[model samples]
Target: MQLSETGRGVLVSGASRGLGRAVARAFAANGDRVAVHYGTRADEARATLASLEGSGHVLVGGDLADPGDAARVVDEAAEALGEAGGGSGIDVLVNNAAVNLPHPLAETPYEEWAALWQRHVSVNLLATANLSHLVARRLIDRGAAGRIVNIGSRGAFRGEPDHPAYGATKAAVHALGQSLAVSLGPHGIGVASVAPGFFATERVASRLTGAEGDAIRAQSPFGRVADPAEIAAAVLWLASPAAEWASGTILDLNGASYLRS
Candidate 1:
């Protein structure tokens, strides 16, 4: 039940950008060796690794949307962590990679729908499951305790009409976390998902820029968008030992907007 992550290892998916990068850097600063998983942005991943707080954090690029690639990335993380001063398995697995294609359901093309659905399922669900399976195996093999943190969206409950697939996929992720928590609890592995609302991420900010971003911020109860670090703070807690008993729970980090409104 250590509060800090010293002498530990973590694997963070989608570390090339956004929330994943923030989570990875948080773990690195706290005392864990990190495996930076990037889907396409190798340079960004490498740069993130370079800027981390500790040595032994490594950048490993892979498109986790592919079934094979998902397992491969976890295996690589395990291997890298083993070589990085700890003779143990990775302590944390973060599933933070996702994509959303906004389209009205009525006008959405079948191909477009399928593509977006596939991306959401493959990357957000399949890949996360694959890595969790690998990490869970490694944890059992080493007889070490571990954690799984899935990055979900407020859409899980908010139910965005234009982002139906994204919302549905996240709702599915919530179900997956519950199942994983019950299934993996016997092996000392905890599973959970953290859903965020109205975070001012670069990708999101870019999309909802100008008046759109302002409106989004205003819609929230707090009347302001969340700082990325705020999201990272929640992740840091979930991965920390203090939260080991908490599993199968979807923590909603909204500013009471989603709940009260």
Candidate 2:
């Protein structure tokens, strides 16, 4: 089994802003060329590309909910970064794109609830599966070592009362990673996931500072939530060659807010 430890090509999905952006920055800072992928946030994606620490980074845009678009996103990223790495495509794939909208069973109508659940499943679960297959196939075909790190959520274990779809899909993601890790081990491919609690990201900045900020922070003994960069650091490590043995492991980044026995 061969595992690479030097500079590589990384593809970060949903990297327009927030945790995805932080993960992209972390990999770029570690000397990896990054392909920043976005759904609808083109300008924000460009900003993320600009913030990377090194060169050879590129921008890729596509709606991952669609299988065709998902394939295009991965192909474009590989084409763009392959040249820099001698035709060896992405060495790392970060499945960071997800949707967490509120659709409480008690409050939401049946139509809206079903729609939201389908949307969440498509973007959060199916897209991750599709991208993972695409990248893993390329690695296997090329006979190269690679890594796939999924961005799961604490809600997968703790439960999201108002967003059951989000929680359920994230749980599926965790399970998917474990299954892939086992299947891909023989190919020298490492697959792992991180389940993070509330973090300081642009998407939830208001919630962090508004009426529920105290309650949210109080959930963790640290009296504060995570910084996006903190989660990114964990992702960077899991993608490294040293973390090959950690495949199939789901590392929690919840700051002691949630625990599973």
TM-scores for all predictions = 0.93, 0.98
Q: Once model 1 is optimally superposed onto the true structure by TM-score, how far is the C-alpha of residue 72 displaced, in angstroms?
A: 1.4
Task: Score each candidate by Cα lDDT.
Answer: 0.81, 0.94
Error of 1 at 80 (Å): 0.9
Candidate 1, 1-261: lDDT as tens digits: 232457678889898877878888898888889999898888888888888997888777788888788777887888888834556657888888887778667989988888888787887778777888888887877777788999888888888899888888888888888899999888878898888887866687685778887788877777887777789889888877778877777898877768723
Clash number by candidate, in order: 0, 0
Question: Model 1 compared with the native: what TM-score?
Answer: 0.93
Residue lDDT tens for model 2, 80-186: 99744566679899999999999999999999999999999999999999999999998998888999999999999999999999999999999999999999999
Query: Which stretches of model 1 miss by more than 4 angstroms?
Result: 1-4, 83-86
Clashing pairs in 1: none
* lDDT score, candidate 1: 0.81
Judging by lDDT against the true structure, name the best candidate: 2
Clashes of 1: 0
